[model samples]
Target: MAIKHILKLLLQQKGISLLIILQVAITVMIVSNTAFISYATLQNWLIPSKLEENQILNVTTRVFDNNIDIASLIEQDVQAIEAVPGVIAASYASHELVLDSQGPGWTMFKDTQPETDYRVFGYFGLDEKGIDVLGLKVIAGRRFYPSEYIKGSFQSNNAGVIMISEELSEALFGNGSALGQTVYISRQRIPHRVVGVYQGKMLGESATYSQQQYHSGIVPEVLWGNRQKLNYLVRVAEGVPERVLQQVETALYHTPGRMVQRVEYAARAKKRLWDGRSTFAFTMSGISLIACIVTAMGIIALVSFSVSLRKKDHGVLRALGASRSMVMTTLIKENTILVFIGLVLGFPLAILLYYFLMNNVHVQSVVELPLLVAVALFTWLISTLAVYLPAREAAKVSPAQVTKSS
Candidate 1:
């Protein structure tokens, strides 16, 4: 009966009811999508590289003299770095350190091709000690053999043995064994045997490649070319990375014809990589919070205005028989109905907005059902609270007040 009366009242003020409903629908659409983006960005920021990041350092060096033997200089630098106290191991690679945000070197590989059955992956060349320096765990196969190590330029494709991440293993070969299988790389279709599979969650050159973060492959090769700088990944003893960082530059200076460009802890570099995205996620969360507050304020003001207009009806109800609690409950139920209708309309709008973001923006997560349900319940809770104070004030209206007004 109260619902029927409330529906009649809402019909009499169609413009106000529709306005509140539209406000709620817009709020729900904006808040939910922004909240989802924030959640996904934070999730990406927390992904582990599966490396001994705290105890590892990346040392970048530039070779300026053309006459020096770059490969021999690299070997000498490696020896000197390893001899430093607290240093465990070090290896040179073609690319910058993992999580440096320099972007990835992408290439295509295939198990068997009708010329189209191929998948793309980011790759970098590493020496035999690269696995140990990066702290990768070999789960299904062996690490690169010492004899497989080679010295080559960045574009050199002469590696005969390749080690892939477990994610790539599942992507290319499914449940079957990837060991000893011949997969072709790049457009030249050069075939290399998969010698090993290791486990790591290292990001592909940048964090933007969300799907390809773990789709990495390492070859048993070290890079040296004209005007190309060298990147050395060093693993140190626990509790001594900072001490070892101080010594790496001096050790590298022992070898002439090159300059130590930079030496930094891998953990610090990884933080720098994700810092921008983390800030963006936090900013979005703040915006969503403000939107929720504004929506709640709107609901409160609308309900208060409606209660002021309905004081006479509330007074007559109390004069007849209705208790204070009954009046409050009826008012709350009416607002709840309005909120429910708004949610019904807002759900589709939220989905459309999500689709627009996925198509036009770089949203990384899919729509989650539980998150949507939670948003709905939260909206309902906010509306209930917003209605409470106004309803309480209206319920205080007595029979004497109605008589005096009349």
Candidate 2:
């Protein structure tokens, strides 16, 4: 009987009810999706770089005159940077952090079959000391023998020895050991033997969806010559002062045939790379908060207005025998029905929006059914609470009031 009466009341006030339902629907769609996106981004952001980020510095230099003896200069610079009080170790690298930029890659295949499976991998050209410089753990085989280390640029070294990441190891050789296995670099017939396998090293952009991000190989070679830039990977000792970077920079400026381009901290480089995702998280958080607030306020306003207009009806019911608790329950039930209607519409809209985002932006906007149910229940509870005061006021109206008005 109460439900029928509430249904009639809702049918009479179509405009206000529709407006409130629309507000709830919009809130549900935006708040739920935004929350999921923000959380996903934050989770991705927290993934460890697996490097000594705080203790490492990348000091890049440009050679003004390519004619200078590149190998000698880099060797001297390494010695100088290592001599610093807080310096742990330093080495010359073609690149710094793996996440900073996509490095050199080669498409490799296990067989000569026409439809053979192949994988692309980014190679890091580093000297024997390079593994220690990046703090990479060689879990299998052995590090590059000092004999394997060559003194020329990557192209000229043509070194046939390389270190592979564990992921690449599993991909190429499966469960069996990858050590002593020879894999070809690209289409070239020459084979480079896998000398070592390291853990916790990543290549390219970790946040990207590329399969080759963690597929890394380290070539035991140094880059030297009329190169435009020289990359020095340096690791500082524990409790090193910030002044160590400036000191390192000053030392490089004194080196002949080179100009200091920039002394970059690994942590700073990572921050610059990840700033975009951080900004997106913050933006979505703000949007979700505003949507929730607007929806809550809309619920309050609509319920209050309905109660005000139905004062006479509430009075008539109270006079006939409806208790205060009964009047409040009826009003709450009415608001819950409206909320349910909005949720029914909002769920489909949310799914469509998620699909739109996934297709357009390529984000992993997977909608969990349990999350949807929780959001619905939460909104229903809050809407009922928002209507509580208005319901109480309606219940407080005396039967004599309607009698007096009539």
Candidate 3:
């Protein structure tokens, strides 16, 4: 049929077609955005933390008593934990895990020159063994020498030396080497020289929709004070039994002034984080499935009702030499026109929702024309399937049966 004829036929059922079009528009908008949200959530859950997640353990302790010198207590605890037989290396960290985003962050610039487009990265204070304990591989430059260690409980006023991850290096300097280069952190523009580049260091939560998570910078500082509670990262030797954690905990708690608040594997914490994201993804998937099903059912109902009302017309056309195939095609074409109209209305609605989410809610979403097109195609596919049975039933209508009833 020509486009104008199809439009005239659709105009005759303007009320029903408009209602179906609105239903389709709403369904497409919800489904496409939900699909994108689910995908982003799942990706974050699946990405590795870029740390020795399995072999590492976290031990957090705090000073329970006020008068106790926390610096001395932390030193004693570190010594005790390191003394455990299965421990390959141990180090203190001001942050529990870089993936948890529990530490400080700084906006860094490649050069000392001021610019507005600076990148943000996690800044952490770690001991010399922090890299080794976390199983981070120094791919370039060199680790901090003993003399470069920021000794004592309090960091000196000197500009600190630091190491960065390969991700941060690439972000700041691309493929070029970042070693021995200077970057300024914070508004003070404190200059820190990158001494080493390591792999598998994540600086923030994986779910964050920013590239800054991989840009981790480490400083060689003891970071122990009465006011500061440091977390211990212990690398257990291979073939170590589960009891090693208990032994390590006991060793740390053997000291008088401090208490071991928690001792657990890093994998547990990682699982906990991913669980939340997974739950969100599953919820979105459920909602998307429900929307598609409801939309399909609505389409089927509208097409079926239209077919019933046009039964006598199909009978008359068939009697006048319209073939069964032609009758089927007419019904299908009418519904297709409705779907096309819905797509025209739905695209803007989806874009408007995306804009509202991106601007007002600060959601992490990528607006892609192809993604929207794919969603429209899917909605049309479902609508076609729903209309097929109704269209087929209309084609089977007999002129004799309609004439006898009349």
**Which candidate achieves the best TM-score against the true structure?**
3
Question: Mind giving the per-residue lDDT tens digits that candidate 3 earns over 1-406?
Answer: 5779878878888888998899888887887777666666566657777766667898887766677776666677778888899888888787676444323346678766665457777777777788788777889999888887775656566436888888788988998989889888777788899988988465555324454557777777766553536588899987789898899888877666567777888877666655765666577668878988998898889889988988998899899989999998887788888888888888788778877876786544565567777888898899899889998999999999789979
Better of 1 and 2 by TM-score: 1
Ranking by lDDT: 1, 2, 3
Q: Report the error of model 2 at residue 394, Å.
A: 3.4
Residue runs of model 3 more than 4 Å from their true location after superposition: 62-64, 102-106, 111-115, 147-159, 186-190, 206-208, 211-213, 222-229, 253-262, 358-374, 404-406
By TM-score, how accurate is candidate 1?
Answer: 0.82
TM-scores, one per candidate: 0.82, 0.74, 0.84
Per-candidate local distance difference test: 0.78, 0.77, 0.76
Clashes of each: 0, 0, 0
What TM-score quantifies how close candidate 2 is to the native fold? 0.74
Alpha-carbon RMSD of each model: 3.8, 4.9, 3.4
Estimate, for each residue in 13-90, the C-alpha lDDT of model 1 and write its tens digit. 787688778877887887778767767766656877676778888898888788887767878889989999999999
Estimate, for each residue in 80-199, the C-alpha lDDT of model 2 and write its tens digit. Answer: 999988898998887666543324346555655557676677667787677788888989998888777776644654778888888888887889998888777666544788888999
